[model samples]
Target: MIDQYYNHSTVYQRRTQDFAKSRRISPASTRLYTGASMEPYDEELFREHDVKRGLRNADGSGVVAGLTRISDVHGYRKEDGKFIPDEGKLTICGYDIADLIDNAHAEDRFGYEELAYLLLTGALPRYDELESIGARIGGLRLLEDEYISEFPITTKSKSIMNVLQRAVLLLYAFDETPDDTSAPHEIDVALSLLARLPRIAAIAHITHEAETSGVRVVVPAPNASSSMAEAILEVLRGGPDFTHEEAMLLDVMLMLHAEHGGGNNSTFACRVLSSSATDAYSAYAAAIGSLKGPRHGGANSQVTRMHADIREHVEHWDDDDEVAAYLAKILRREAFDGSGLIYGMGHAIYTLSDPRAQICKRYARSLAQTKGKGEEFALIERIERLAPEVMRDVRGTTKPICANIDLYTGFIYNILGVPETLYTPLFAVARMAGWAAHRMEELYGAHRIIRPAYNSVMDDVTYVPIADRH
Candidate 1:
């Protein structure tokens, strides 16, 4: 077992190194500084242009632009029919928002129905189309035998997400038609990957959990199940002990989160790699790396921790006054910015509420009722009620800064006996479908490489020798 583990580690490391090498870019040869004046400088005209443009809101409120890129397709719009860019140079903050948040953007923050529309439709796939995709993938479960055989299993107690990452890389390696981004095959590959990823994820989860707990290696029962969620639930339950309700909820959650808009970590990974003409596996591996970031796929863990903290101090959280004082103290001590920021609350795109959040919230409430423990539900309600008020008091705005799907999903999964660590992996399982869909779209569209230009504003200076630096 030890030798086998070392071998797996060696292979995994080699593959990782290879992936890094493949994705690397050589530095630009000609280094030109923007600040360097070209020939005759038009300072007077530049000043005049700046004065006319104004310091803020240079483009006026009514000006609108459309984007063909994955980042710009938030499904919701304001009353004026103008879609807000979650993260772009045009937004208040020039930083890119998390892909998950960007994908969930709707006219109303709480537009669950709109989200449902996106999930059913690939790029606004219609209701019937969504049903077809779901039906097609539902019957497809478990990875191909070759995939299962080639999947690298290390003895080290690895992060499940990391294992999934390796699996994604391997998927690229094993892709029979790495260069074929055309019709039927591309669509088929996307559907197959979408169907099997949940099983792969569950295998990773069960394998790692078994290793940690010293349980027997139970090869997941052959995929006799109809739905991908059911197959995974079987693996998790280890026998026929799993409940029907749990299976149904898991199915819905997986289906709902399968895809949103695009430009999320995994989807971005798909887009970036597909742009470069890489295969699906390579694209997916890149995405997994992006998802590893705390701001992206790791939000669920943070949400869980916040809930835990609140629950631990539930006695102290008597009323709005006490909650305000506690929150203020934490903020002051932590030097937190008054952004009304809370884990799993407020979306960059959605202003009303996250539809997924609503679904998960309902499921969580149901689970609480089933278990007859109202504490979690009560805590969620209190936080939901208090969060907006707290934000309003601190930030001078009472906009609907409700909890997103991550928070609700975290709550539901926690109540369902899922370890907090597996939360993101589960997210990955559901999101694999969306990632595959986006990758297929990019590949079919033959989009150009996603290399966005950067505008620098820093002053230029000459490099100095080390000895003469001072």
Candidate 2:
């Protein structure tokens, strides 16, 4: 009994010390740490060193890094050695995205599964093949009870994406062969995650609401026969509280967001991690972390917040001059987070247009009209039209600019009753297909590690003794 008491005392003492050490850092120490870690580089140094900042060329094109058979993003053309803006085109595997959407809608079938299959395998599936694929993914939609009971929704994170990242990492512990990078195992893991992530995101959103509002939400068990889009809505709404049109619209959205070429930030992050021979879960978790950045998948939420601010401050949504004035203020760093960026207004590659945004714009208008939110949709449309002009006038640049997919997706989600918190999480759900595809490519196609060289700009200095440093 004495020995047991002594051991317990020692463990408790260690835990107490750890708890005390984990306390928030003092403000003074934080300032000192930030100052010591600060490293600022001059813009001119990039040009002098012939460096491609952010791996982007001077004309804003991504540096040709690797090849891809998954999808192609075409936004510009070169003519006579001059940069030329062109209508954006997104092709998945070998099929055009617009044609895929059109065919799926015409047939009145969910297309996200088909798109996912095409991304994973570089070919469109026949009817029977598509049925098999859907059945497999739908069957995997229901997560393991242990996972639901122990992870994600019960955790303390307010950010759904953070929960999602943890949920994915947690899966690594459950898999019997988590490190298997063979084709069959990798594909199975990818499909399982593609099915399970939407459910996790829905539960994470509910968990966040419970924490904030103290109202517990019960997520319904997923239907194995339901499509991915339908399953997400059912879980989030706690039942089948959505329409056929709503489900179809969301399915189209999933297809459009499923892949955006290999160079996209999240997919590239997945590729980079996969190139290092990590497990599928780690690579996917890294992709989720990258997507959570405000400049990437999180841009949809930023766009929503910016629109909300415009709705609150602007007097009239219909008046072009009034909207233009507010947008000019945004571009001039005088309003809306003061970052000098009209969020969702431009794309890195798409200058003339974004094909995904074009489709969403059409569907968003129809849905907004039905939901009696025509005025709000009109305001968003107006912003899309006027933001480029305002930017040109404010910044004095002649660059062609157009709205990206982020602009209309938030409006669509709102009409569907999705919360702002789920905006980026939903992006992760859709882009899981892309990230998995890229991971496969990096593992199988690219045999070498991705190691980019960085040019050091800091001057070498002699080390001083600890007593003489100050």
Q: Per-residue lDDT for 1-470 in model 2, tens only? A: 32454445455455445544576656446444334234334456688899998899998889988988988999999888788999999988878999999998999999999888888888889999999988898899877878777876455587889889999999998899999999999999998998899998898888778777999778788888899999999988889998998899999888888999888899899999999999999999999999999999999999999999999999999999999999988887899898888998888899899999999999998988788998999999999999888888888868799999999999999888889999898899999999988999989998989999998777789999989965
Task: Quote the positional error of residue 376 for candidate 2 in Å.
Answer: 1.2
Q: lDDT per prediction? A: 0.59, 0.88
TM-scores of the models, in the order given: 0.70, 0.92
- lDDT by residue (43-124, candidate 1, tens digit) is 3443544542211223222222112333232324456654443321111011122332344333212222223235323354
Top candidate by TM-score: 2
Candidate 1 TM-score, true structure as reference: 0.70
Model 2 pairs whose backbones collide: none
State the lDDT at 17 in candidate 1: 52
